[model samples]
Target: MTRWLGASEVAARTKSVMKTTLRSGTGRIHFLLRAWRPISSHTSPVDSSDIISAVSPKTLQKGGDNGNFKQDFMKLKQPRSSVTTVLQSGNSEAQRTSITKLRRVVKKLCKSKRFERALEVLMLMETQNKIRMSPADHALRLELTIKVHGLLKAEEHFNQLPNIASQKASSLLLLHGYVKEQNTEKAEAFMAKLKGLGLVVDPHLYNEMMKLYVATSQNEKVPLVIKDMKQNQILRNVLSYNLWMNACSELYGVGSVELVYEEMLSDKNVQVGWSTLSTLAKVYTQAGLVHKAFAALREAEKKLSSGNRLGYFFLITLYATLNDKEGVLRVWTASKAVSDRPTCANYMCILLCLVKLGDINEAEKIFKEWELDCRNYDIRVSNVLLGAYVRNGLLDQAESLHMHTLERGGTPNYKTWEILMEGCVRSQNLDRGINFLNNDFAGLKCHD
Candidate 1:
């Protein structure tokens, strides 16, 4: 029988190896950076087109490339020298690519979810430019490590840091990684260790732990986090109170949740937002307190900013849950007024709301409106109406919508097939239902 190594044990074992490996390979780190280079080994004049393609504002903003972005980044003159030297050289054209420009490119890559490419550029910034890594940068590197590799590799990276025990940011970042992975055991142990390191005084750490507990269905542990915060005299932030309220909502009744809200309101340090009100309204709606739910929702609407479509989404959803068609349409119109055009997500939200209210005609009109203006052919939007039609015993409309989706270049996802199969089974069309299930399995195979 093999025993599994705990997080600490794994960290300890990997630390020495990681340090030794890094030390031995520090000189050749630039080579690792250049592995993505599109050019040959021989030194050639830097092509302006290559430079433009890699770090231009348009390229950075949109993260689009002519199938060569991953391959052609940071035109280097030599392997031994820093990018700083190349940029500072007498070549005025090369001087255009400043350190700031490189940093911007890295930021864009990160925003676009190109972590591997972002890591490569970040390595260039560090090894090639000899830039100092700030605390935020350390946290970023740890996050990147978690993304590219896993929690274990991130642990190894953290362990290799100088004064590893004292660095709060890196420690918290690792804790966040554990939380994100939902490894309750390791997260608990690491959090305990964090407290010993005198880093638990910050409410952010406690908030993260509470969020983890809530996510993992450990609602009972959420109050314990609050108790720990009170004992430590840590001032609760908005997020901290919100998590407590959420946990209360899950584990107790509306009254218990309301008490938490009252306490949050009294806390001068924390300002309640539209999110808290929405959560409260959800609880109220569930409890059949229509008047109270409506009151909370009204307050939540007032708190909404024009640019914050998320609040509108939540509001629209809750209004639908309350069976208010007028409220749903009102919020949907508000959302579109603030933006250039409604996103597929926005259409889905309202479509779901209308469908839930049993307003098939209104939902169909909304679906048609989406079908006309949607840049991307999202089968999900069509599937919402398709599922609605099937649930309402309108199998013909569902079939017609399915055909229309196929004509519009929309590919059927698993949910699409499942919805259609459900309709087929309801109509007693066993042959087509069998075909759908087979097709779904085939799709899975092709995906794999």
Candidate 2:
């Protein structure tokens, strides 16, 4: 009898290990940093060009008489102790130039999504220079931490920030992290602490709190937060109003939604966008105001200019929720005509709608088309189709699709296996169930 760990259990264990690793490794400079030394008085000034040329592939390949590329490559890749020493030993102007070049390289790496290397460069700059980073720089590091590590590790890093680096920007980054994780309790506590410290609470922070409240199903707290924002003289933005209306639509009814919409229109700072109109349409549909909903959707479409794939996708989603299949197709077609090229996300939206409408054939067609053109494959799209097949009792199709995905070098995630296992169990296919279990065990062993 093999036992499989549930998703929650896996998540808990993963978080535990991450927290342990973060605590142990926090504030520890990379081993490579120890090798770096300030330049000596006897050494000549290290030119920026010298640094560049030293690491160049041509220089590495020419290191030996025999042109030993491997040895040269290894030397180039190894961190040079003299590199930092030379930078720090230079005159003020020379040092500034070196720092500037390093900063540019760091920025480029970050833009290219090479966050690990970016962080290493940042750490080297901070450790070697012994200069306090700007508040904005600290905030950037905080965001990068959240990106490279998970929220738990990010929060630990936030707590370790020096007092000077702990500004509103850093606080907001942590608050946003908590909101994203939907840790409402932690968000509220952090907010209270910030207020206790008499820190300036921006309108965006209040909006994030409202979002956290809404995400946690505590919609009643939203209006209270909005009122607090007003009392504090923080002008509400369009997103603030939309979140309020969404909460009201869920909690009160269409009447409350209309009142908020009216208030939003009156606010000088609030510029109602397509999201606002879409929110209204959703509320109207919920209240059984079918005609009003359609009108709102039309207004939303009118507001969107050409090449607005997201806006069109939103409209299609709203129509699909109302079971308007024709409306979904109409907007999707119109979107294709105007947009430069439909994104994977756009195709995903329409495929989901088709599946929801029980139009599996169309969904399959769209999925195949996306497969042909999508440069970056998304597993969620395949999972959606798999879900539809399983729900419709097309177990054979689901199994075939799963195998096909595996053959294409696509790794099936936990949800993929879960769905197949559930389908097998429900259909009383014992052999298939055993096969899925065996495959899952094999995957676990491979991971180990």
lDDT of 1 by residue, 55-147 (tens): 344333333343333334433322213343434455444444444455555666688886776665555555534355666666777778788
Q: What is every candidate's alpha-carbon RMSD to the true fold?
A: 14.0, 10.1
- Global lDDT scores for all candidate models: 0.73, 0.71
Query: Candidate 2 at 333: error in angstroms?
Result: 2.5
Q: Where does the lowest 10-residue lDDT sum fall in candidate 2?
A: 58-67
Q: Model 2, 1-448: lDDT tens per residue?
A: 2233343443343443334434545434454377444432223443454342334433222222223322232233222332354244435554554455455555765887867655555655555554446676677777877887677877786777777446666888889989988988889898988887766456788888988988899999999988888888888898899899999988899999999999988998768888899999988988889999999998897777685677889999999998888889888877876747787678878998999888999889888987888776666678889988888888778867865665454555667767877776767766756754653544533332
Cα lDDT of candidate 2 equals 0.71
Task: Give per-residue lDDT, candidate 1, residue 186.
Answer: 92
Off by over 4 Å in 2: 1-86, 89-91, 108-117, 127-132, 145-166, 181-186, 196-201, 305-308, 337-345, 376-380, 386-390, 393-429, 432-441, 444-448
